[model samples]
Target chain A: MSELLLQKKHSSYYYVKSKLSTGLPLFAAIFLVLLIALLLLHFIWHGAPGITWAFLTEAPRNNNTEGGIFPAIYGTVFLVFIMSLLGVPIGTATAIYLSEYARQQSFFSRSVRFGVNTLAGVPSIVFGLFGVGFFVQFIGKGIDTAAQTTIWSKPSLIWAAATLSVLTLPVVIVAVEEALRNVPQDLREASLALGATKWQTIWRVVLPNSLTGILTGTILAIGRGAGEVAPVIFVGAVYSLPQLPDSLADQFMHMGYHIYVLATQSPNAADALPLQYASTLVLLILAFSLNLTAAYIRLRIRRSHK
Target chain B: MSSNSTLYKKSKFRPFEAIIEWIIRLTASFSIIIIFLIFIFIFKEAGGLIFGTAKELKPKKAVSEKVQDKSEEKVKPEIYNPETGEIVKIVEVKKLVKAKETESQSIWANLFSDTWQPVGKKPKYGIQPLLIGTFKVTLVSLLFATPLSILAAIYCAFFAKAWIRDIIKPTVEVLAGFPSVVLGFFCLVTVVQGVYSTTQFLQPLCTNIADIISWILPFSDRWIHSALTISDFHYSAVVGGIGLGLAVIPIIFTISEDALSAVPNSYREASLALGATESETAFKVMLPAALPGVVAAILLGIGRAFGETMIALMATGNAALFSWNIFHPVRTLAATIGSETGEVQWGSLHYNILFFLGILLFLVSFIINALTELFVKKYLSKKFQGA
Candidate 1:
């Protein structure tokens, strides 16, 4: 080393002190270790089963030897569909109201944000309670009496869907708001300068720009709706109903709750094992894919906008 | 032209803008309507158990009273088999027994019993055991998880290097992706097995170790080694604590990390420039600054751990002991409510009890969340002011 450089480095206490500021590696080490451990456990415990069309379509059997999670998979898909239909537009509109139109810093708007945040933090069980009390009972009335087509035939699915939608709506609104906020204010001003009405500016410019983010958030909310077991169990989920719901009113089974029950309550070791893992895999895949799709859209939009 | 426009605008705000403002204001106000509706529905569903049920439950209560009265009855019934006939008539003996039996069902009356025998001839739905179990598991979990998460956050926020921070931030969040069922499975298949065995092996070893330590310290051998028994550590509060802890670790880590990072860098720099070490700056300076948010994280973490269903359902043995012993089995409200949903008929007392459990859960987490929000709001308000 050069004598001048060597002297300066040795003379300064800053060099020694700078080395002490390393917490990042520690954090990374812990995180990676935990993730790897969890993944390894998941893969190791959940053995790959031979997936067949028969396995995916058949019902659980009288004996604990052969059955697929067809009913559960069917139920989860229906749930995600309902949650998306109910949550998407309402959440998008709410986000638009918060970000584009409203001065959310105002007291009224601030309180609204507070409510949304509180709702977000409320436990899943509380949502279950609400689902049971509201959807299954109060709202179940008109739909419950169909009596012909579904196990529940009349009421449960719509109510559960509505409840799940509201439960996840806050997250959608927040994500959508963030996405909308990411739209540069200059774009809005430019539109206004061209004599566009506020609604026209928002619809033509702000919303189109934010669509990617809004979709991502909406999908994320759906993923949450999919994995949930607690509230839906109370509001819906009949015990191991053998058949799939032919219609909305048809009573349903669920993957998450099924896994919970099979693993905890049922003693069908070999039979339920593969089915549980497969069902879990299906639910995880659904959640992951939805999240990934939304994330991909957001990334694409962001790149173009940038 | 600008002055004319300004004068026109100053004379009165535009009616269209005013209307738009009102619309915006109304949308914000709508959340209140949402909360109210939620409360109304939850209370109504839960309300059936409280005010609406008199037939099934009330008759059971009367039956129980008759049973109790019979147990204390002084007189006996005379036998009546005067003729060999198809009709079988027996005279009642103890009025008290009949009164108690008429008053309530044993199963229904003992809903608060520490033991849960849901499938017995005299089915019991004693949720007290489950509630106690829930409490033990939750308390243990929060105890285990809260500290580690907060510490991890603090270290990451103030002390970690660049590459480590980047990796840790997202990596820690992976916990969020691990579904609850997966976690429950892990606890049941792996963790429970590990704990059960470890408790067995460690009992003698732990007792010896404790005994040895106690000899050096103040306690006696019997107390220390007995503590080491397999029963002491197997399926104990510690296992549930660890599982629950893992479940909520990311939640606490994320929130606390944000709060810690939100503390101004200037303060850390200033404290460090005064010759205090980086550790001192983190411990004495940033932590105190981020205390409120950290507290919020802990409270929310507590709430999460408390309400967590799947983990407790799979891991805890669901024993309903009122005893505060950590080694014994515990039942929680969520788990019992969850497991019973399939078995219990809708509108039954057990079903109502589940709703009641939901009410308890709602009331608790609501308070925790309210406090968390209040703390976070105040913390941020103070934080921004300081900044």
Candidate 2:
């Protein structure tokens, strides 16, 4: 480096330009920090005082102006739980198909990839509409007509979770596919050479190795499902439900939807301000923690692989 | 153990394995099926509006007409029920299927107007305002996000020290995980207010260009104000756009950063060895080399912004208005779907229009995604094949 510097003897103009260039990264990093700080500050300023154990656990009173958001929290968890339960299997299977089974350049694989990509690009609101059209009005109403009852004809938790599962399908598929692709081909060949069938090799080796990735995908989907509001809006979520949903057919409260209702539909948006912020804070915490956990797990897995 | 070994030998051609494989393959195809179903259902529902129903045949009216038409040659067609082998009741299914009266006006004329009143005496389904709103928010967000993210990406890829790169990359990527709803909430409750106050503070200093224009033309100042403000210190496109910018930044940064980092080390070495400073090397050499990929990143960012729903719905004041000004509230197609889908009557013109909007959003995003993929692929090919 010193020899090169001696050979080059750069001009002062070039030196000043390089010095100024360093500022760009510094400026960018500082901007990011500031944005994060501002978000944190807003949450702390409005949400801190209102965030009590009771607020976290108790049901709201006074048209949701007062009391805790226990139901909303529970509903969000349950919704994400259902979404992951249904989404992960298909997503993982698709990942396996793409990674291990389908020839990459084949039309089937390409179309599957295209489907995943297009699904990812579809707006969440469209998913909501799809839920209303396919799940509620069509399927739900069909169930009602068949059973001669209206029990299955309305928006419910199952429909919302199903909608969200589809919405998060790409996230899981991409994550698990990346994981499955990372599994060494040498191990698979070795396993096959040892007389294990393709299925056995995948089951005993590839899936076990990609466990972290599957979990990462599940965690990311949970975070995404928990925070999404549009797909749940008409399909199931309500501002206030009589009780926590005991069955998939029941409507439920959600933190994101609660915040929306408080912000937009509350008779007194001002009175609900603190509670709204608190719900937003809770939603942010839940989502960020899920994402951070996924990231941390991925980091650990990468480190271990190294 | 000997018996189990024999059993395993007997099961060499495993039916269980075949079944499992079939199940897995079926599961893998679920997404394709759902995508097809989504397209089918949305279009079918929208078909009610596209091809309006043949007039209402109320049960009472139908029965009376059937009684009257029974003697006529052009009577209502009927057939025996397959199960009962008898003529069954003909259920009339024709209410709520009025052909849109826009027959008096051309489709282009109706769609290009300023009003978006969908449920009044004369329903005007002018999509012009929605398009303007969507583009306004999208353009504003892109204008803010693309440069910042690209610059940041460039810095991270080429300029940042090791520790800084390690810290910055993950943190910024984590920002992508923050749901648009949360961002929308923050903007609605906090950021928009902040922007409003800042705008107020700068109001005196920031003279409106409209002021000059209004002086030249004899238009009312309120017209400019209406263009500028839904009201002072309220939700506006600027706030929604900035919120969208926040949502868009992570996407652009992540992709552009990858592209920048993917540039061969040889280029950097050559540039640096040529007596160019690191910044000049980055700005002149690395950036231009990664330009296609960066452009792809920007396109994907635009797709994200265009299709984003919750943030715009929560922050854009949900007003369907036609205005060029950034200060006023603007309604986006995704937001309209989010806010209005519930209230709209099923199979109504309003309902179908929302789905039509969804189709429009879907097509735009589909094109953008395809283009981005093409650009990124070209960039990758160029990188590897040295085109």
Candidate 3:
């Protein structure tokens, strides 16, 4: 009887140990989910009240402690728009070359892949430095020297957009390539079997199918580009601008930079707290909506393909 | 049928197609060119300092002497006759000799010293404190993020049902979507206050633990005492690290979850068939198989945290303090560049130093990526070869 009791105790102890181990990881996952929820709630709770139509439409007044963030919003939109125009086509073409044309493991393809990976890993601040050194000092100054004008030699919207396009290139390439790879080999084979040329098959069959994916890539790149402030800090972003940018040559305000300046450098930061929260809220909503749309498109593609 | 035959005949020598393909290939190679351009341009800016060719160095002695004379004149107690516009009395100051000692030191000595004051009359461009700050913040962030992410990854990979997985995955992606600046703002506005209070509450408990550890292990007393003491909690490395950890968690989680799920089902079955518990199979068989990927994920996460700028700039107090206390305010390399590079003269020594820090950040991330690539390749080969 005692031996049986001891055996029962041992089994109970093992059962409790197993339960504890599983419980620990589950608790961790729950913790992370709750943390995210709490963060979002905190932002919305404080920031939602400050968000109004006027707040989104008018320019800041009184040393950026009052009024709205209209100029920053405009600049951010313009920045990302230019970035996508420059980045998407090149990224899509590169993705096509990698997925549809280049032989796997070829030296050139491998080198290109390595370059993409390295570019993805590079820090944003270094990108800013590169922008200043290459775009502002080198190319911009080169243009100025040729034109005999000082317009291009300083930080401006064009240089910032160019730098951001470079930064977002890897994101677009990865997304578009994944989308291209999802197009089945049988479809490509069938197109080629019909006596269609390689370019015709790709342009007709592959590109059509991956159009949503390419759109997704562009949206993702835009989302990333809109939110990034470091690369714009030296290239074009200013703390405050009295007027909206008229051209790519003009320096402009950015949402992220505006928030940063308000949080760190405002003369009366406490008084500006509501404006800071409201600005962060707007930026967050923009980024989240863009990311969600891209994710939704990606999910639909995956489901349809399956 | 006649039109189709004509089209086929026309497609036989499609010059446009060949040209388009070549253009596509060239555009694909632009990534490679851009990478080289980034390296060359950044290095070009830093080359002045690295090669000692900056024009600032040529007039260093004259500049230092001018600074010295100005500093001495300010320190001296002098009486001025306003009508005559001349000094009637002057007292010699001893600070002149000490200033001379610092000014005469070699550039390398100043570069490696503990201070990071780059804007003063006699600028000291020491980089040690920034390096230490970056190291401390990265270490704290890794400590906070790695285990939590890994555990969550394990649960999502091996334990969670399909429905739960769907919810958790999207939530993590939302977290990932948060802009770093937003995270920095959150930390500045809310998290620092929360952390400060929490640390203040935990101080006594930590002191008690330190005392017990010192009593239990005499050899570890000094370091443990220093490590556990939370003197001040405002805008510290610990707070900055937590902010950064929030940024890093999603990257580590997604990669690690993919790796863990990629572990074949056969290993799970084999372990289970041997009477191992479900958790046991996950811990022993699946995790070991996915070790390479998990390690690669962690390295990538480290790379992300190491060079993250806005969070470090906003949350870490930007003090450039040389201390091991996790609760002490610290400044990082990227933060220094972000804050100082704006107003600095384009071709100044301070600008070159910031670029030098950029070079350091670039090299570190490059090495991390190369290492991660090596691990991923090794894992892929092993899996395909049925090792």
What tier of docking accuracy does candidate 3 attain? acceptable
Better of 1 and 2 by lDDT: 2
* Candidate 1 local lDDT, A1-306, one digit each (tens): 579756755765656544543444355447545754676457445744635677678776754346776787788788778888887777777777777655535676667777787677666767776776666655565355654323442336766787788888887888888788788767877887787766667779888888788778878898888877776876676557766777676668888877777776676666677766766666667767776687677777677767
**Candidate 2 deviant stretches above 4 angstroms:** A1-22, B1-19, B54-109, B206-233
For model 3 chain A, the run of ten residues with the poorest summed lDDT: A5-14
Better of 1 and 2 by TM-score: 2
What is the C-alpha lDDT profile of model 3 across B254-313, one tens digit per residue? 999998998878889999998788998988889888999899999999999999999999
- Rank list by lDDT: 3, 2, 1
Q: Give, for candidate 2 chain B, the lowest lDDT window spanning 10 residues.
A: B1-10
Reference contacts reproduced by model 1? 0.32
Query: In order of the candidates, what TM-score does chain B achieve?
Result: 0.77, 0.77, 0.83
Assess candidate 3 and give its lDDT.
0.89
- Candidate 2 matches the true fold with a TM-score of 0.86
lDDT top scorer: 3
Report residue B142 deviation for candidate 1 (angstroms): 2.0
Q: Distance (Å) between predicted and true CA of A95, model 3?
A: 0.4
On the 0 to 100 scale, the lDDT of residue B106 in model 2 is: 44
